[model samples]
Target: MELLCLLLYVTVNLACIEGYKWTRQNLPVLMDQNTQLLEQSLFREQVENMNVGQFEKLCGIECQTSLPPLNQSEQERILGYETMYDNGTRTHTDVRLRGLNTTESTSYVSSLTRTKRQVFGADGRFVISDLKFITNYPFATAVRLSTGCSGVLVSSKHVLTAAHCIHDGRYYLESVKYLKVGVLHLKSKRGKRRRQRAVSKINQQNMKKRPVFRWIRVKQTRIPQGWIHSKNSTTSLAADYDYALLELKRGVKQKKFMDIGVAPRTFQPARIHFSGYDDDKSLEGTQGGEKVVYRFCSVAKESKDLMYQHCDAQPGAAGAGVYVRLREDGGKGRWRRRVIGVFSGHRWVEVGGGEQRDFNVAVRITPAKYAQICHWIHKDPTQCKTV
Candidate 1:
C-alpha cells in the first residue's frame, strides 16, 4: 500500500509539472491579448489626461527623452498630426517618424519604369519570381510566419508584419497556435550537388534533399490599439493601422535584416520590392519551388496611410515588407534599401452608395507608427529614438 501511494504521488506531481509547462508556454499570448483589452479604457483616460510617462509604462515602453520639437512645416509634413477617424474626428496624438532628421529635405528620385505587368490579371496570377535564395537583398530579409503570413526582419530578433495576420479585429486567429518564424536554410554548393545526385538515385519517399527551414518561436507580440476595434466600428475596416511587431525568442544568425525607414513626405512614384511565401506558389514545380517569391512594381497611388500597387501577391503574402531603395546619407552614388510599409493585402473600400473599390494596399510606416514599432522591438523608447 505504501508503494502504491508513492507511485500515485509521483504520477500526480508529474502531471502537474506538465500542465504547468503548457500553461507557461501559452501564458504570454493570453496575457498580451487580455492586457490590451482591459487596458484600453485606462489607456484612453491616460492619454486624455496627458500622463505621458505613466502611459508609456503601461504600454510596456520606457519613457523616452524629449526629442527636439519639429518646426511648423516639418510637423505638417509628418503623419499623425492630422490623423482622422472614419467619423471625421481627428486624433490629437502626435507620433513622429524617427530617423528622418538625418535624411535630406529634398525628395529622392526613383529610376524605376512607370509601366509594368499587372499582378492581378489572369496571366499575372501565380507568377513565379526570379529571386535567388540567400543571394538577394529582400529575399534574405523575408521570413514566414507560422500563421501562414509573411514577415520581414526589422531587427535581429524582431519581425514587422500586418496585425490582421495574427489577430482579426475581434480575436486572434485560429492558425496562431504558436507564434513561430521560419527562415530558409541555404545549403552549401557541394551538399546541393550531392543531394541532387541522391534524389536521382533514391526513391521519391526516401529523397534526402528536403527543404530545410529554421523556425524560431516568438516570445511576444504587439498590436496597435487603433487596429483593435469593435466589429461594427468603421475603424475596424480601416487598413491604415494594420501593422504589428513581434519579438522573437532568439536572434537569427548569419542572416541579414532590413532597416525600417519612413515613406517619403511627398508622393513620388518609386519601385517597391517585397518577398513572400505566397500560398498559391508554395507547391512543388511552382516558381521558386516552395521558396520565397519576390515581386516588384511601381507605386500606383498613395494616401496618407496606405500605398496602392499591383505587386503580384496572394493571400499568404499579407504582412510582407514593402521596401524601396534610397540614397544612403544623401551620398551622390551610394544607395541603401529600407522597408517602408507592411503589406496589408487585398482590401475593398467603400467608395459611396454601397459601391466598393478593390485595391492591393500596404500600410505606410508613418513616423508615429515607426516610433511605436521601434519601441516594441527594443522595449526601450530611448533606443528607438533614431528609428
Candidate 2:
C-alpha cells in the first residue's frame, strides 16, 4: 500500500507535452488535495530550531571571518522544459518561484553564508565508491541521466530530475532523441585481494568502471511551461519550475526509490544532503569516468521556488535529488530520508544594478509542484489528492 502511494506520489504533468488534458479540472483537484504532509513540516521545524551557538561549533572558525558580498551570474541554471512522449508528443505548463520573508535566525544564517567560499574551498565532496553501500537503498536511488546529468528514482518507473536536463522550454536537447537512464547494479567481486587492492588504489579501470549504470530506455519526459523561455519572462524566474519527470520502460525490480517531502518556502535547515555523478577531477583522486559524489551543507538562501547553497559540485551533478534525513512522525525517533528538491546546479544571475551573481541552486518542490509531479507519476488525479 505504501508502495502504491509512493508511485501515485511520483506522477504529474509538464503541460501539453504528453498530450494529457491537464485542464482546469485537474488543477483544482490537485490544489484541493489532502495534505498528509503535516508531519513533513514538523520534521523541518525541528531542523530549523538549531541555534547559532550549535551552528558556530559545527561551522567551525570559518564563520568568524567574512567574505566580500557576492552577486552571481552563471549558465548552469535550470531553464526551459517540455514534456515529450516516446511516440513524439509534447506538453508544458508554467510554475512560478517567489521569495518570502525569512524568519530564520539571522546569526545562524550568516554563519553558513560566510563559509560558502571560505570553508568549502578546494572541494569538500566525497565519493561513494564502496559497491556494497552504493548499490543499496538511499544511494541506489541515484541514477545517471543520458544528457551528462544525474537523477534519482522516485517511483517504480518514474525518475525526478531537473527540467533543464532535456528541454530548454523551446526544444529538446540533441541527446533527448536517444535518451537513456543508467542504473548502477551491484556485481560480484572476483577476488577479495584484487578487490581490496583496486579499492585501496582507487583504480576505476581495475574496478572495471562500475560507475557505468545498467541502461534503461525512457518512455517519456515532462517539464513545466514555467521553465520554457519567452518574451514575457526571464530564464531566472523560469528556474523556479526547473524540474522534470521521466518514465522508464519498466520498473526496477527490488529497488528502492525515495519519498517526497515538502517544507515552507521560508524554512531553513541546519544541513541539506545530495549525491550525483561528476567527472574525475572534482573527486580527491582520479576517478576515470565518473563517480557518485555526495556532500552536505547549509542553505544560503531559500524562497517559494528555489534554494541556494554553496555545496561543492561540478558538471554532471545537476538533477541529483536533494534529500533530508529526519525522524518519521510518531515513529518514535525512527529516521527517514526523503527528497525535498532537485539540484539545479550553478547559476549566474543578473541582480540589481546589472550585476551578475552566481549561486548553486536547487528547485524546491512546492505543494502545487508535488501535486503536479504526483499526477504525472500516478496518471490518476485521485491517487495524487494527498501528499
Candidate 3:
C-alpha cells in the first residue's frame, strides 16, 4: 500500500512540472523577454506616422547612446526614421538608409555612380585568356516583390530563391507581389560560354520568352515569422533573422529546380557570380535592352554586421540573391552549393567599384532563414511535397 502511494505521488509531481512548462511556453508575461522589441515596434509606427519636416525633437528609439541631433543634411536624407512618442506627441528620430522616408538630399540613389565597360572575347566560342581573371564564372537571375526578393526557376515554374524574399511588415501576405527575374550578359570567357550554352539553338525553347526575359509572376509567397519586424520597440540591425520562400505563378514543368544545398561551417571566399541590370551600363554604352551576367571576387575582409561579396551589380539588382558553394559532411566531405546571402547591394554606392574595396554588404542568410522559409514552403497541405 505504501509503495503504491509513493508511485502515485511521483507521477503526480511529474505531471505538474510538465503542465507548468506547457503554460510558460503558451502564456505571455506582461514584462516578457521581447519587451525591447515591443518598444521598438511602437516607436517605429509613431515615427512612420510623421510627415516630412514634422519630426518631434529628441524623438528616438531605445538605445544606450544618446540619439544624434539631426543636422540639416541628415534631416533631408532620412530614408526610414524611427521615432519616439510621449503623451500623443512625437519625441525621437532614427533614420533608415532606404525606402519610404528617403530624403532627396540623403537617399542612396542620390549618390548613384558607376563606370561602364564594353566586354570583348574570342569570336564564336569563348577564350579563357580574353577575359578578366577570377571573374570567369557563370551567373543566375534573381527578382523582388513587395516583401523581399526571389530567384529564377532553373527550367520550370518553380523558382529557387531566398526565404526572406517576401515580407509584409507583419506576418501578413498583402505586401507580396509578382516575380520578375532577368538574366544578363557577363564580361568573362566563362560567362560568355554559359551565355552561349544557355542560348544555344538546341535550347531555343529555354531562350527567355521576351527580350527583357519573360517574368514568371509569383502566385504566392510564404514566410514563417509569426511577428515580422518585431512587435516590440527595439530593432537590432545585427544579422539574425533572414531568409524567406516564394512560389511562382505556375509550377515548373522541368526538373531543374534544386536547392543550392548547404554551407560548411568553415567557408572560404571565392570569385562569386551575379547578374543584374545596370542603369549606368545603359547610360554609358549598353545597346537597347540586353540581359547580362557579371562575375567578380568577393572582398577579402567582411564586416560582422554587414554581409559582403564582390560582384558587378547596381541599384536595380537590390533584391538579387547572393550564393556560394561549400563542402558539407555527407558520409565524406562533399562539395554542395548553399546560398549564404542576398544582394542587399551597396546601400551607399554603385556595385563592383574599384573604390570602397573593403565591404560589399549582402544580407546573410542562416539556418534560421532556411527554417522560416521552409515552414512557409510546406505550410499548406496541398503544397507539401509527397514523400
Which candidate's TM-score is highest?
A: 2
As a whole number from 0 to 100, the lDDT of residue 232 in candidate 2 is: 54
lDDT of each: 0.54, 0.58, 0.32
lDDT of the structure predicted as candidate 1: 0.54
Q: Count clashes in each candidate, considering only residues at least 3 apart in sequence or on different chains.
A: 2, 32, 42
Predicted candidate 3 versus true structure: per-residue lDDT over 82-174, tens digit per residue: 111212222222222211121111111111211222222321111111112112222333332333333533334434443333332332222
Best-to-worst TM-score order: 2, 1, 3
lDDT for each residue of candidate 1 in 149-262, tens digit (9 for 90 to 100): 789988888899987677554455544545689976644334466666666443534433334568998876666645655543332233466787877888988456898777
Tens-place lDDT digits, model 2, residues 25-115: 2221232112121111000111211221221121222331232211111111122234576656554433322221122111111112211
C-alpha RMSD values across all candidates: 19.2, 15.6, 20.1
Error of 3 at 336 (Å): 4.0
* Candidate rank order under lDDT: 2, 1, 3
The model with the greater lDDT, 2 or 3, is 2
